[model samples]
Target chain A: MEVSARNALKGNVKALVIGAVNAEVTVEVAPGIEIVAVITKSSAERLGLAEGKEVYAVVKASDVMIATD
Target chain B: MEVSARNALKGNVKALVIGAVNAEVTVEVAPGIEIVAVITKSSAERLGLAEGKEVYAVVKASDVMIATD
Candidate 1:
C-alpha cells in the first residue's frame, strides 16, 4: 500500500511485547539502531508479526515533532 | 520535556512551509538524509522554527506503523 509517511525504515522485528490493548514492537534497522513502535494488539495480530520477520516501520510526517536541545 | 519515543534525530531545519493551520518542516539529519514533518501552526510559532535552526525530529512510538513489503 502507498502511504504518505516520509520515513520508512526496513528492519527485522527484534522483539514484541504485547499487552491488553497495545503491543510494543522493536525493529532493528541496523545492527544497533532500533526503532520502537507501540501499535494496537489487533493490528499486531493482523500483521502476523514475529521475531526475525522483515517489516517496515512507517511514520507519518504529520505525527513527527520538532524539538530543540 | 522528556519523550518516550525511541527515535530522536538531530538535524537542522532546512525549510518551512506554513499554511493557515499547519506548517511543513524539513529537517536534514545527515548530509543527504532529510525528515519532513507537518505540525500545527501554533506549535511551529511557539517553537520559533526557522530555516537553518538546529532541532530534533521526534516520533512517538505509538504513532509508528508497521508494514510488510
Candidate 2:
C-alpha cells in the first residue's frame, strides 16, 4: 500500500493490551526501542494482532510535535 | 514531558522540508529506518528542529489503525 506518511517501522508485535474501545499495541522496531500505538479494538481484532506477529506501526499525523531538552 | 501516547522514538533530525504552514520532519531512529512527521511551521521553529539535531517524534493518535496482508 502507498502511504503518504514517511515513517514506517518494521517490527514484531511485542504485546497487545486490548480495552473496551481501544487497544495499545507495542511494536519493538529495535532492541529496547519500541513504538506504542493506540488503535481501535475492532482494528486490533480485525488485524489479528498478537505477540510475535509482524506488523508496521503506521503513524500519519498532521501534528507531530517535536520535543527537545 | 509526560505524554499519554506510548510510542516515542529517539532519533536525530535527518531532514526537514518546510512549507508555508506545515513542515515535514524526517527522523532516523535506526539504520535504514526513518520516521516522517508533519508538524506546523511554528512548532518546527519553536522546537528548533534541524538536521543533526536530536529530537523525539511524539505521536498521539486516537485512531492508530492496524494492517496485515
Candidate 3:
C-alpha cells in the first residue's frame, strides 16, 4: 500500500544546513528549529556542509513510510 | 510549485512513538533513529504517549519544505 505524501507531515520543520558530517548533520534553519540531522558520518562530511549555509532537509515519503500498532 | 515526494527522503528514519509530551515527543522507531519531534507541547502530551508504544511520526512534505539564501 502507498500513502499520499500529504500523510507524512511533521509541520513547519523547515531549515538550512549549518553543519554536515558523514552521518551527523546540523541545520541552522529558522527561528529555533535547529535540527541535528543524523545520517552516515561519511555522508555528512562529504556533503562539505558548514556554518551560515542553506540546504533543503530532503526526506522521502516512502523512506518516511510509517506503520503503527 | 510542488516537489515530487521522492525528493524528500531522509533515509531509514522509520520509527515508532515511544513517548509524547505535547511539544516534544519520542518515537521508539526502528534502529537508532529516535526522532525527538517538537510540535506544540500540548499536541505532545495530548497524544498520551508512553513507552513500549507505537505511533506514526506524521510529517508533511510541504511542511518539511525548503528555501535557500
- List lDDT for all candidates, in order: 0.90, 0.79, 0.40
Residue-wise lDDT of candidate 2 within B1-69, one digit each (tens)?
688865667889999999999998888877888778888899889888889999987777553445565
> Clash pairs of candidate 2?
none
DockQ of each: 0.68, 0.66, 0.13
A41: Cα error in model 2, Å: 1.8
The TM-score of predicted model 1 comes to 0.80
Across B17-63, the per-residue lDDT of candidate 3 in tens digits comes to 33344234445434444444545544435555455456655444333
Q: Is 2 or 3 the stronger prediction by TM-score?
A: 2
Per DockQ, the best of the predicted structures is: 1
lDDT of 2 by residue, A1-69 (tens): 778765566789988998999888888878988878888898888888899998987777564566776
Q: Residue B14 error for model 1, in Å?
A: 2.9
Instruction: Point out where model 2 deviates above 4 Å.
Output: A61-63, B61-63
lDDT of 2 at A69: 69
State candidate 3's TM-score.
Answer: 0.32
Q: Give the number of the best model, judged by lDDT.
A: 1
Please give the C-alpha DockQ score of model 2: 0.66
